[model samples]
Target: MSDKHSPDEKDPHDPQGMRGGLTNYGDTDFSLFLRKAFIKGAGYTDDALARPVIGITNTGSAYNPCHGNAPQLLEALKRGILLAGGLPMEFPTISIHESFSQPTSMFMRNLMSMDTEEMIRAQPMDAVVLIGGCDKTVPAQLMGAASAGIPAIQLVTGSMVTGAHRGERVGACTDCRRYWGKFRAGEVTADEIVEVNDRLVPSVGTCAVMGTASTMACVAEAMGMTMPGGASPPAVSSDRMRVAEQAGAQVVEMARRRLTIDQVL
Candidate 1:
């Protein structure tokens, strides 16, 4: 810890030395002390923050249930990173649920990607874990990570569980559209439509379909950006949490190896 440095001795946490640009304010011992001072406000002991820093991209909000499990996922990731002798820090970027953004979610996608890339480059993490789902989040993260050139791994928030309405199996926007179509043709009553809405999304997660979110998750695995079987699981399932923890531990190894995004590509 830079907090423990003795006078007349070099501060090993210098950015050019061990911290790798994280402590780049200056090479002086007082510069290291200044960096550690404000960071201590987060209740971190010098020893904890002294370890390699792992950044977590948190793209969750109340408006986006697709990323509802982000906090749980982040906690699990932090546990594994701690066990692997690393410090995990969570930061926010723009969250884009398919139905929330105006003027088109696609229009907002490039902006989110730019936000992700800039934040990753500006932060002090040695490596990053991109946690996202929803329609645009995954690709935006990929675009950002690719440009940032940092060691990065992507984790999907997983799908929502299938719900039930009037004793029939119901999924997400797929089923939602089917029922709406019937209503539009005057074949179903307004009352039935309202009832179906309540049962469509059983839990907090992205659309439970083979749409963009799930497709990107699978693609990430195929491209070696995700762990084996990481693409398959409900967001609320224990399996998703387990995979998140594993991602955290794995990123530490990536940092140790100095595996930049170029290496993965």
Candidate 2:
């Protein structure tokens, strides 16, 4: 019996790392050849490319303070993926901050969801981590992930720390509304309100209270879309970074197990 095989013969050991979803260039071999050639330009060795690929959505934006910790989260996630024997690939998607978007962030949620779904399908990844912190962003990512039908997980940006105002621990946006009401009733001076403004958001993160962002975080956790205790870590805390790392490592395992999103949802 001959042990030799033709180059065109499918390799039984080929996992869906860089081998999945070949571009329709009318030739499978050429598609893979060109894909590897282009990816190699990014300094990825063939060995690194052989590992399961984990896609991560980067929704960090300068206009979105809620996701300001995205860069740190990205680094932690990559570290975890590498340690777990997977390749992490971060890609940008549409970001919608509630306070910054015109006509409201809700209007843009579907657009972001579509972007997430299409990107996951277009990219070559065995599993994906949806990194988002905004109110609409979490749901948008999940909606897209469900549609994409791959192994998907959600990693929230976490909440903000409480700030102090006049010896009282306060933060947005309940406190913000309280102060505005006080100013309207002549209980607070312009200078006092100005001071309160700085204290409402002492750090860059989502609302400290259980507002939309935090609510959605809990929702994802409850729906089994996120790791255990993935809901309440503050953005600046080391715990959040640990959660990010753990989520990264878990997603790689999910990829290896072929845990599709359909199984979860």
Candidate 3:
């Protein structure tokens, strides 16, 4: 009997990239051929296709203003991936926001998680960057990436700018609650309450205060799921875009080293 493995046996440690999780066609070569052919229709060259693939999730929607910076972040991420010699592919996923979701955002968290997991499993990327903000979105992405077991990392959309109302700094539901409490106690007028609504959220992005969205961002960073200082950048700041670019560059290295999700978790 031969002691060495057969040459036909696949190398489990090989970089998956565009070759990962091919569709079942009963023929590995055919499956890969079809995938490459279709992907090439998108104008990918053989040299580019040969590079490591990095997936970035697009969770931006009009209703989810917390992720309004998705387009900018995606662009920065692509720039970083290409600079680092990797292919960046952006994919869409279900996005949930506390203010917009029917009933509650929590009700839809599991569904988003399932979507994230299945998308990662079905894609051909060697590693993925989960771009999320808001309360439930980050948790959902983490849950999904954990189950997918790929080399996955996170990039938060970041917080919003603090606005001033009546010369007082205010942002998000936290300040909204405070004002509402005062309004209920007859300390603030109905007209003033209505006027302050416009100033509460002066821009698009997550809560500026230490709400669930901000909390989850920090948790992801502290848990080693994101780069240092990944949690604090405001959504509209140049720092956030830089962080996204860094995330893209970092994920390429993670793919090269096979830094699977399990390692981080």
Candidate 4:
């Protein structure tokens, strides 16, 4: 694709051409004045504020380290949206960490879906990028976006790094349980078990196993909800940031193309 844009660059899909739907905002001068005055209160200027709007769904929580990179990802996404000629706005939804919720996170997945659907419905976004990690958050977001039938894309928080112990590579929960079982069976000492626990989850990210979190990541990719190969990036890698940026740019394209979620799903 050509990266350069001439002075006469135009989006064929843009309904109002290069100037956008400014005239549709108002046919009369008084109506235009009221609209501009109200929007200006949000720190918008006539020159910099006519771009399409992109919404970002943030589902981070202190309880969910799988999303530890969320704030950084959001900033990167916003930068990409701005660079791609769109206005990025982020909003929060209920974060459901599998380990933290009671009665199973599965039970509350619908609640998160409802929250996401309602927020997207009430918002003025032309397109949205749903950011999530953990076990159930991604699914809930997908369900809600499907129901809302808007232009939406998904970005996962990425995978966790592998843990290590005395020249042995380990990870979370899976190995955690394995070693704990050994300890319970009197096959390993208490000190060894403690050491295993310390070595597991040495980095900030999701479960380092093919658990629900990883499974959901794979499902998101297989369903074509996310960019190809996005599901496997290590959470702390700089590549994850690039993925976030691309997500922002892609949302703008989706909005311009009017490719709503209903069309994709």
* Model 2 poorest 10 in a row by lDDT: 6-15
**Using TM-score as the measure, which candidate wins?**
2
TM-score of 1: 0.91
Candidate 2 residue-wise lDDT, 77-161, digit = tens: 9999999999999999998888899999999999999999999999999999999986899999999999999999999999999
Candidate 3 error regions (>4 Å) = 1-15
lDDT of 4 at 8: 21
Provide the global lDDT of candidate 1 against the true structure: 0.85
Q: Can you write out model 1's per-residue Cα lDDT over 6-94, one digit (the tens) per residue?
A: 32244564452124445455555566567667878768885676677898998889999999999899999898888898889899999
Q: Estimate every model's Cα lDDT from 0 to 1.
A: 0.85, 0.91, 0.90, 0.81
Candidate 2 local distance difference test against the native? 0.91
RMSD of each: 3.0, 2.8, 4.8, 5.9
State the displacement of the C-alpha of residue 40, model 1, in Å, after optimal TM-score superposition.
Answer: 1.6
Which ten-residue region of model 3 has the weakest summed lDDT? 6-15
Looking at model 3, the pairs that clash are none
Question: Candidate 2 at 264: error in angstroms?
Answer: 1.3
Indicate whether candidate 2 or candidate 3 has the larger lDDT: 2
Model 1 lDDT, residue 161, Cα: 95
Residue by residue across 171-196, what tens digits does model 4's lDDT show?
Answer: 98799888989999999998898888
Candidate closer to the true structure by TM-score (higher is better), 3 or 4: 3
